[model samples]
Target chain A: MIEARHLSKLYSRGVYALRDLNLTIAKGEFLFLTGPSGAGKSTLLRLLLREELPSEGEVTVAGRNLSVLSSQEVQAYRRSLGFVFQDFRLIPRMSVFQNVAFVMRVLGVPVPVQQRRTFQMLKWVGLQHRMNALPDELSGGEQQRIAIARALVNEPQLVLADEPTGNLDPDLSLEIMNLLREINARGTTVVVATHDRELIRRVGRRAVTLDHGRITEVG
Target chain B: MAALRYAVEEAVASLWRGRRSAVLSIGTIAVALFVLGAFLVLTVNLERLAADWSQAAELSVFLADEVGADQQRAIEEALATGPVVASRAFVSQSDALARFKQMFSDLAASADALDANPLPASYEVRLQPGVTGEAVEELASRLRQVPGVADVRYDRQWLDRLLAAVALIRRIGFALGALLTVAAGLTVGNVVRLALHARRDEIVIMQLVGAPTAYVRGPFIVEGVLQGGLGALVALLALGVAFWATQAPYLVPLAAALNMTAVAFLPFITAIYLMLGGMLVGCLGGILATRSESR
Candidate 1:
């Protein structure tokens, strides 16, 4: 589903965010990119998302090279992918239902379908009762669940999460991981970037560890 | 169409969120269009008055007292052959005196006290419907050169001056309207910029979620258009009220001076165009503000 050949991202003078990295993940595979600070985890995710272009190499996802896509093509490519953030990043003014339905609206889905999908997705996240509540009113765990529902509302084939449980308690983190695992079990590709090695050890998935902008180990 | 609907909903919501700036922008647009509308009203009515008088224009050729009958006949022949002359009536000296006494009864004694009847015999020559002012001037000059003609006066002279004044007013209106419209556009852009800043987080999130650039910027554009459209409405209402309020006190007397039966407001089509123009200016502002945000 994804391939990175000699992927190197250079920042300003003498600063390399990712150095000569080559990686691959098969379709429907759940993977973890574990690294310490400045280990190029988020930078790699950004490159995969086509949010940034690699300085020296190309990253391809689902068969299209990310480097050559037009502005409009980039938008369409991104619509097929889902992204979750540590901050939840939900629009504060929107209710849980609106936040989840926003993706469908952006895709120009029919209003009836949007409502139905949003309701179903909220139920799946176990936030159906809190659908009318604003993001500020929800706990960190519930907010992250709503964020997950939003990410999945458009039925994207791949979901990339950056520190998805960085703000939650241990039990809440485990719950969110379970939700991600269930999604993976349903045949969606998942890549999570985090510094939490304990969670990585428990998940027992393919883990790629990086240090100083280079891959150090793959277990 | 779906995008347009979303834009409108988002625009309305955005305007509601930034009601203060919206009101300010709308007020600015209203003032700009109102000034332009006022001049438009003036020019429209003044042109109407000029047309009315032009249809009734006449030239009066006053005859010399000692002119021979043959000289008078020659002048009459010239009037008869001229293409610009629709009709002509010869007013004898006695008839002219009689008209003076009838029109000014209180001053009849003053005319009686004058020696040798100061009024001269004249021919009142009505012009053709669509004769040019230059044609009337040429005809008047030709009449003055007639052997017995003392002087020639064309009523269209004053009408020509009035039309020139109307043109000047129209140009001034256009210039002022253009300047105000620019200012209004800038105000709209500023207001939309403020809204963009307030919703920067939302915008970033939208972009991250792969919202198209149009979807992200659509609401701001719609917000500008609403401000302009609402401003145009307010201007039209104010212009109507001002026209109605000035009818008895100001416009009535002005119409009387111009010999016009009534003063007219702006035409329905012109008002519609003004509304559309306001919206267009707003759209421009929106476009200008978001030109840099394209990703």
Candidate 2:
């Protein structure tokens, strides 16, 4: 569950990154945030993640107020959600297994459980064969899959993917999007930010469009 | 336990990944600690030598020739009951003359040319342990007041000068050691900062994945402690080598005089304190480096 009431972010005097934006999404819903560059989609996700606070109003995720959580509490809150970045953000020196298992490691899951779940998640994302391969050695598609596996390994209730397919070929982008769809079908809420209308059309999820720091449409 | 192991593994991994920086930091710490350790060794031995000199201080109460056996006995009784006197021995005129001749064997013929026994009888006075400078002076004044005692003398000025020099050396050594410790800490901080810069991407990713600040900072702290510890070890090794190299016939007598074992392993207490100090410096450096925004 999530709620944002009149959330606005001001980067500087006379410049607004997000202007009094308000939105809501139910549990287990998959949504797309679409807009041109500088449309506040990333800002909204960052606010949800509590990486930065809104200049005005509040955002809540999983019943916890983002504005009021202490830094330590914010970190704990983040652990309950998953994030997939456009760049995959894998530690290049680490193997695929390490990349995916990192989330579990942070959460202090027992070694045996981490191994089992990481292997299972990698298999689900069709990356089990590349477990020992470094991020640099993997294809763009494989790397994204590894990122997806990492995000899902902790079984977070909500997953936020910031332009998850921004660096991939069309075919690879579609594959990554389909994997996200599969994750949503398995009951994880997913919100993706991207301007790729073709991919948006292909997936046909509920879409929220923003422009000039305000949400312009929703379908 | 599992989390701690993971943290330690991460720390070791970071050190390995940034081996060049680690080496540089460790070397810097070693050099700083080496200077500190050398100063400490010198100060410790010097203090010991000063203490030995202070403990050996004695007062000589010379007696007049007109003092007969009865007056000498009276003075010996006064000395025996003196609170400051730990021990005392009477040196008769004959004994004193023999000692003077032995001390100046080249002047034996000159001494024999004297018509009468010129040496005066005296009482050699050893004071109680931990007697102060004022106490020594008071005892000397007391001895001068004794019946038939002509002169009471001790090397008070020389002892005072020796103590003052020791105190000055200690103060300077403390200041220099503190300055080098700070330098070592900053060097470690710079190294940690470089390691953080090299792994910035990983740090960002770690944050995004919900790793706590402690989790992210833990490895750097461990790295700092390891660097400091290794540096201290190197310094100890160097000190041991230097001590060994110089502990032969050159310092054996000095060591024996000071009642210290020749080239014995660094006193356990001193070694422990030095290691603890090194670890603290490293910890400070780690904390300084982690104060910046890692994400």
For model 2, the superposed segments whose C-alpha errors exceed 4 Å read B68-70, B81-83, B253-265, B293-295
DockQ of predicted model 2: 0.74
TM-score for chain B of each model, two decimals: 0.90, 0.89
Estimate the Cα RMSD of every predicted model relative to the unseen true structure.
2.0, 2.1
The collision pairs in model 1 are none
Over B218-240, each residue of candidate 1 has an lDDT whose tens digit, in order, gives 98899889989999999999999
TM-score of every model versus the real structure: 0.95, 0.95
For each candidate, report its DockQ versus the true two-chain complex: 0.72, 0.74
Cα lDDT of model 2 by residue, B1-295, tens digit: 6556776788888888888878888887888878778777776777666666667778788999889888888788767845577898889899998999999999989989999999898889887656677878877787678778899888766778877887888788778878888888999998988878888888887787778776788878877888888888888888888888877866787788766555244577888888888888888898889886452
Share of native C-alpha contacts between chains A and B (below 8 angstroms) recovered by candidate 2? 0.69
Q: What does candidate 2's lDDT look like per residue over A1-61, in tens digits? A: 9898998999977789999998999999999999999999999999988889999999888
